[model samples]
Target: MNFVGYYRLPPVRGVFFSPAQEERLLLLGCQEVFSDRCLAGGVVRSGLDRALTALEPGGVLAVPSLHALAGAMVDLLDVVRRLRALNLDLVVVQPPIDTRSDAGFFEACQILAT
Candidate 1:
């Protein structure tokens, strides 16, 4: 199984992924990193699409935070559903969520429920 790192910069002016964030993902054993810079009022997430497509069943997707993954609750849920359908795991470094663990999985569900 591979651990792939993904990050996104909001439409604001900033770098793709901060050095420390990339370092953290690397420390967590991520083999590759994918990133996106959101365009103002844009809905396309080509980077996320590529990352998901690159992973096979049982692969892992690591991100710095939930907000970095998606902007809205519905979008987040859709991403979670896709991860489940693809048989992939998720690891969020900040706020520390790991769907691979029972407690973390429950926490994820709770977060989504709210």
Candidate 2:
């Protein structure tokens, strides 16, 4: 399956996050994975918009970690809502959450609570 992915790694950390994430996605049998790494909430990422537009119907957005979406829960929630409207599945790898199921919904709520 084709996937568009998004992630963020703090610049201060020096270590890159995308390499590991790309490896994971590739191992998952993803034919293609488009990703962008940015500082969370630092700026509007145009790559996300392009990725969303590139997504085929029923395609997935593989986010290796949920926190990469935003630093705030509200921002994350907004992103989730918008992605849902586009009928794209969000695959959050670390916690193994998929927004396509009830369990995922509950897990998401749990994450938002923290």
TM-score of each: 0.82, 0.71
* lDDT tens readout by residue for model 2, 1-114: 347677655554566446777777677655566554555447455656777788887878777778866556776777777677787778788878876664476356547756
RMSD of each: 2.7, 3.9
Worst lDDT 10-window in candidate 1 = 101-110
Per-residue lDDT for 46-87 in model 1, tens only? 878888988889899999999888888888888887887898
Scored against the true structure, residue 14 in model 1 reaches a CA lDDT of 59
Against the reference, the lDDT scores of all candidates come to 0.80, 0.67
Q: How accurate is candidate 2 locally (lDDT)?
A: 0.67
